[model samples]
Structures are given as C-alpha cells and as structure tokens.
Target: MTIKDTAEEWEVRATETPFKGNKTSVRTDDVVMPGGSVARRDYQVHPGSVAVLALDDEDRVVVIRQYRHPVRHKLWEIPAGLLDIPGENPLHAAQRELYEEAHVKAEDWRVLTDVFTTPGGCDEAVRIFLARNLSEAEGQRFEVEDEEADMELARVSVDELVRGALAGDLHNNCLVVGVLSLVAARHGDGLDALRPAEAPWPARPFEV
Candidate 1:
C-alpha cells in the first residue's frame, strides 16, 4: 500500500503539560486519529537512558536486584541509568552507571541494543551496551546510601538470562532486550555491526 503519511496523519491539534517532575513531565495532546475521530494522547516525556550488560570471564551477565516502588517488586535488572546530563556522551553515561551500580569497568564496549521502554505512554528510550573484559574499579569504594544501599549484584550465565527473558520471567526491558540481542548477534555477525562508542543518538531529545 503506497500510503503517504505526515504530521497531519497524526492530526495533533495541541499539547499541554500537566505535571512537571524533577526528571520527567506528563503531557496530554489533543489529536485526531486516522479515522477522523478526536482523542487525547497522554504520555510521559523523558530524556532517555542507557544500560550496560556487563560480561565476565565465565561469559555470565551481571544482574542487579533493586526495589522499584512503582512496581512494588525487587526486580532483577541490568545496570542502567537515565541520561540526565547536559552534554555527556551516552557511552560515558553507561560506563559511569555500570561502575556506580556494579563497581566494575569493562575494557571492551559495544552497543547491544536500543529500545523504547514504553512508547505507547512514555517517551523513555534506552540504549543497552555489551561490556566485557571486566575488572574492579577503585572509585567504587564509597559508602552506599538511599537506593544504592540495598541493591545486590550478581553474575548469571548468558544462557540463563536468555532463558529467563524467553520464559517471561524477566520483566526488565533492558535486560530482556540486551540478552536477546547478544544471543542474536552471536548467531549472526558477532559484533561486526556493533555501533561505535561515540555513536550519535539523534533520537535523544534536545534539553529544554
């Protein structure tokens, strides 16, 4: 079907912010759907994020358990954080997050996958990276407090991670995508297509 589409296809009439949080904001858009019906589209506007899938010598992936108050579950997840900095590179952000959350630095870094967390109701996007050749970072000796205090990290085999994702046991979006992406890549080009460390992310929105 040769269907030509444009912003008019979305039929967005106007938009307004209802709640502006410290890191995110909620916006509602008045719009018309494809069938000429008017509607309201509400979504959270986010600045995006990065996640690191830390790999060890045994080919296991690092997983962390954290308490998510919203979901009310101490879900196991990969090391990840929001890209909240003004001009920090996403890879640098990922490296910092991996060290902060897991206290490990990787000598080899490659893009694993990029995903939109919840495109239907949120603008949150995350780029997951694969980091190998790991070692302890001396800068991670600081005392943990707040959310970091109760977090636990461990290494799980890549096969197990992929199994958990496929069996619907892994709920964390980044972990699921990262594990599957690595599995797929191993069966395919093996890192021949991994993006550079300084890959340009045009999808990351401009700061307000």
Candidate 2:
C-alpha cells in the first residue's frame, strides 16, 4: 500500500459558520463518524499561504523577526504571506513576499515543501519555496505598519538556524519547515530532484 495522505471527506450532516473574520472564518461541521455516531468539529478556514526560504551564495537564509500577538513573542521567520485570493499562483505570491519582507529577489526557485500549520485546528496550508541566486530588489522597499513596522531583518547561516531550531529557540512554523526541508533536500536525492517552483499543489490549486 502507498504510504501517503489521500484526500477523502467524511459525511457532513450539517455545517455552519459561527464567526467570520476579515481573511478567515470559524467553521463548524456535524460529521458522521464510524459506528454511526455524529460529532461536531470546528476549525478555522484559511485562504492558504506561501513562504520563501531565500538562500544566498554564502549559504545564509534571509529571516525576519516580528511580533506575534497570539503567541506574545517576537519569532524569527522566513518571508511568508497569505495567497490573497482564491486560486492565486503560489509562486508569484512567494516572490512577492520575498521582495516585500526581505527586499530580495532570486533567480532560481523550487518547491521546498508544503505543510498544514495546524491540521487539527486550522485548514491553513502553506507552500514553502527554495530560492537561490539572490540579489537586492530594485526600487523602494515596501512600506510597513503595525507589527510589521517593527520587524527586524537579517541573514543567518543555515547551521546557526539549525542549531537554534534544535535548541528549541526558533518557533515559527515556516522557518522550521523550510530549513529542515532544505536540509533534507540537500542530503536526500539532491536539490535538483526537488519539484519545480510551478509544480501543482492540490491543497491550493492555481493557474499557470
């Protein structure tokens, strides 16, 4: 049998949206379970997201530190952002995020990995991309406000990031996933064997 996740939906007897936010909503579904029992499951419905792990020639990864109110901590993370619209191209979103968050651009791109931030609680799928051949982005940097206005930018060696992650110092989901996935790809079949940047993402379909 293939050891891979398959898409299947259980029977939903009823569904409702108890809370609706600007970019997401709380969804409650009365689902039919085994033994003919019904259960209510509530989860956050998100528009999906894209993240960029920009690697420079010196093997440093571009990172940012921002205040996360929910977690009440300034977590270091790679460039990431929401899809912005249904069926938006993830590669484009990743490029935009890398530029806006780090003022950087990349000549090479590949699919590093994809993950579900909190599968048990939220339906937020994130596509992480591996970006190399980096350079400074042209034009004025994107303006920031709110928590983003206080964001700190830096480039740290991958070894240091791996050490920090293993030491339980880094907490951002994207950074952890991106860094580990990059390491895996490098040590596995190799980076060239990774998926193309425009590879299909069934979790978040998009146009070419």
Candidate 3:
C-alpha cells in the first residue's frame, strides 16, 4: 500500500520547541497517524552542517582521529562543522571548518553531495564539499575541546580511503559519502560536473 493511502494518513497537532541550544533544539510534535492513532514525536532540530573532502596535490585526503564519546571510540572523520552562525555563508563555513579542524585550506571548492543525517530522528541536513588545490595554514593550531582535544590528523590516499570505507573499516557517514562522491566524480563526469559551492539546498530548513 502507498503512504498516501488512508491507512497511513497522519496529522500533526501542537508543535513546540522546548529546548534551544547553539547546536540543536528539542522539538516535540503531537500527531494522529495510522488511521486516528495518536502519537507524539520528539526530535532534535539542527541548523545543518558541512563536511569537507580536502584533497592535496598528491590526491591524498585529510582525515582526523577524534574520540566520539557516544561511541566510545576514536573514529576517523573528514574536517567538518555545523552552521551555527546566523549570517555565515555555507562555503565560508566549509573553508573555516577545514582550516580550524585540520589546519588546511583549499583554492578550489564544489558541492559534492548533501545528506539527511537521519531524517527519521532529526532535520540535520549536511552538505559535503569537494576541495582541491590545498594549502596548509602556517602554524595552524587546532583549538578543539572535549573529545576533539586529542585529535590526530592523517592524510591517506583516496584509493585506500575508498577501499577502507567500502570494506567497513571507517564508520563516519560523512567520510564514507564524501570520499565516494569525489572518487566517482573524479573518474566519471569530472569535478567540473559538480554544482557550484553556492548551489541551492532545498533540504536546508534553517536560514543560516
């Protein structure tokens, strides 16, 4: 049966944002679904985030080993950050994140892909960028806290990154998706086929 069928119809009633934080918000919605059944869905609302796939001259990718307290493991992830500033541009945020997290910058950038971090639980839309022509920010020091305080940066070949990701060696969603998107575009339609860094994001619900 299709979701449009009467058996799956639902209507939302009261919606409220009970908690608002710099990074997220707790939104609770009262609804009646599944043919008059009542339900309440509480979830986090995020302003969205950006992920950078920075490729150096040799085509190696920059990754970081940061501890994820939720998972209790030091996981590998690409340089990324959230869109928290009210007036900040997405491209500038991507550039800032790469520089801040990995101490690097890029001369070329494009929109590689976008992802819904988890639509079932949150409206956390994520944009992935493809960055090349990289340069190291001189004397760049990462000012991260908590689990990121002891982060270790590594540059690995794209081949290895792709293989490792495909073999389930890496766990970060952004890293896996970003790496695969770049690899495909590089060898398939070419990086020029990607959308501009300022491409419109229909899934981005927040203003900033």
Question: Among these predicted structures, which one has the highest TM-score?
Answer: 2
**Count of clashing pairs, candidate 2:** 0
lDDT by candidate, in order shown: 0.85, 0.95, 0.86
TM-score, each model?
A: 0.88, 0.98, 0.86
Worst 10 residues of 1 by lDDT: 4-13
State which candidate, 1 or 3, has the greater lDDT: 3
* Backbone-clash count (model 3): 0
For candidate 3, write residues 93-171 as lDDT tens digits.
Answer: 8998998998897888999998888877897889999999998887747678887788889999999999999999999
**Candidate 2, residue 122: CA error in Å?**
0.7
Between prediction 1 and prediction 3, the one with superior TM-score is 1
Best by lDDT: 2
What TM-score number comes out for model 1?
A: 0.88
Error of 1 at 177 (Å): 0.9
RMSD of each: 3.5, 0.8, 4.2
Candidate 2 TM-score over all chains jointly: 0.98
Model 2 alpha-carbon miss at residue 127, Å? 0.2
- Model 2 misplacement above 4 A: none
